[model samples]
Target: MYGLVDREALLAKVRAQMHDKRYRHTLGVAESARRLAERFGADPDKAELAGYLHDYCKCWPVEKMRDILVRHDMPRELLEGEKELWHAFAGAIVIQTELGVSDPEILQAVRYHTTGRPGMSLLEKVVCVADYIEPNRDFPGVEMIRALAEQDLDEALACALGGTIQHLIEKRKTVYPLTLLAYNDLVSRRDAQGGV
Candidate 1:
């Protein structure tokens, strides 16, 4: 039953803690979230709030993130390997416990914004896709994904997941198994329905 936190206060805290680059990314995400919310018929305020706070815990030290997860008794399987990616779940906890946000939709949106999962809610998909295809994102082929986002969310998600998987492979980084599963799930769902 918690209500949305004060947006300005939340942004202030994030700005105080994050470096300029990270803060810019936050702003980009907020804009992207608002845009996607409009496109998908979601609440723009909630989308902006969720997107702005999606990375609240991203700036925390790795040890602090680990401690938060450990104290919450987060499943070890989810915590194992890819310690860098633990911030998303930890951020979910922070959003609920610290920010007084109780909405499952918003929490899930923040939780999966990084790695994403199957059967994501509309809000979740918006935040996830926004984070990936935000206008300020200048990675290779981002324009293509942005176009897909404008036209078809599912296709955009598929492309983003494929790109992420490929990038991880190229960097020799450990690809989270959930990411691959999410990609396949989206692809399968899209194909089964004749596209989304």
Candidate 2:
């Protein structure tokens, strides 16, 4: 149960901080998160909050994000990796230090929104999957993920994670180890339960 977080003010801050296209994506993620929460029986309000704030630092200058990474002592390996990954890790720190969000669940959701970790909480899975399937994410296999999400959250997330890994491999891009760990955990869980 999260306390009051001033949704209106948070939305305005997100609107001001992000560009129009990013803001629209954030809104879509929020709506998708809410829907996923409802389907999975998570707290929709909290999921929406996490979605709205997930990209809080997406538009920040590279220098500022790098500074946050330095301040937070992010691994040098990650620092040398994709610039896009900075937003999730740095956004988690920024929301706590700047936006005064102290809720651990919300913080964890923001922290792991990009490279999901093993043993994710329900809320975390909801945010990650919602982000992947948010409307406007026009990638191959998105519709299958959307349909799978409706039927089973874990299976949908495993599929989404697998898709991400495949995409990264095809592009010869860096693959975050934590994502692999998460995918392995999800796949194991689904298999243990006889697949979802």
Candidate 3:
């Protein structure tokens, strides 16, 4: 079923949704997602597609994203929390309704790419991590996350989530609950592994 998606058509649609910089970032994320998926034993194709679709609504007007969230009856927490998190959830619905994407895994990946949830799938982890470590991304700890990604996906993602939480704290911005849950889940899993 995944094989049937028109790659060029989808790419064109994704490209149309953002400015040149974001489109370039999307491309980088797609390639990076494919690489991460291969390294982590996930479906490379699904990872790439999710990467392309992940930010489909990122540059849209806040009002537009809010409208979609309201129509979809998204969680009140999400609706009230950071607007930065809206794009992922709204993109999931937009891709399905407008772009004909029906794969649950891919949709889930897009939905959680920004604010990762507890018990994320490998594909979701791939896209989320790819978004952070993509070539266009240049935050302070990105290189460390990229390095950790090469060795351990969970470690890399936990580090990335930690960085995000810290950044939000520094900015006095609200930290989304799911992101904290995701980070804690990774930490707990590592602890359960006897601190390995």
Candidate 4:
């Protein structure tokens, strides 16, 4: 079990950080993460906690996120890359310094939830996929990914990440390297297991 956590306090802090719409999304992700973790053998509490805190800095000014990334010496690629990805990296640090979250798994979950990396833990995958299939999310292909998640987490994530990559391509947006690597890792592992 995780350490004794102040759930109400944490929720209050998280709610104060985002707008109404995003707060609803965060709640959805927390519920979805809890469900996914129950099905996928992750710690449901950790997954839900990660869900609530994942977007802690999502509504912050890009300059503020970039400042934290710089002062914390986050990877140069992250600092230089898309601002959309900044919240995940910056949120992990803020939760620790500001919210007193010290668990490595929760921190990593928040860090990689936006742009997944290779060799992700089960909790990480749960939080990441939950972000996609949360009830508040209405993106195309989400239902298919949700169905896939019930059967296989890797395949579900592969489908979701592939969709993300293709969408980026269609919009002429740059796909982060770690996203590609995470997709490849899931696909390769599935192939090795004789799955498509």
**lDDT by residue for model 2 (161-194), tens:** 9999999999999988889999999999878988
- Clashes per model (N, Cα, C within 3 A): 0, 0, 0, 0
TM-scores of the models, in the order given: 0.93, 0.95, 0.96, 0.96
Per-residue lDDT of candidate 3, residues 140-162 (tens digit): 98999999999899999999999
Per-residue C-alpha lDDT of model 1 across residues 36-155, encoded as one tens digit per residue: 989988888788888888988888898999999999998777778687678899999997998788988899888888887888778888888999987778999899999999988878
Q: List candidate 2 segments past 4 Å from native.
A: 1-5
**lDDT comparing candidate 3 with the true structure:** 0.93
Poorest 10 consecutive residues by lDDT, candidate 1 = 1-10
> How high is the lDDT of residue 188 in model 1?
96
lDDT of 4: 0.93
Q: Give the residue spans of candidate 3 off by over 4 A.
A: 1-5
lDDT per prediction? 0.86, 0.91, 0.93, 0.93
Residue 37: error of model 1 in Å? 1.0
Q: Which regions of candidate 1 deviate over 4 angstroms?
A: 1-5
Candidate 4 ranges with C-alpha deviation above 4 Å: 1-5
Q: List the residue pairs that clash in candidate 2.
A: none
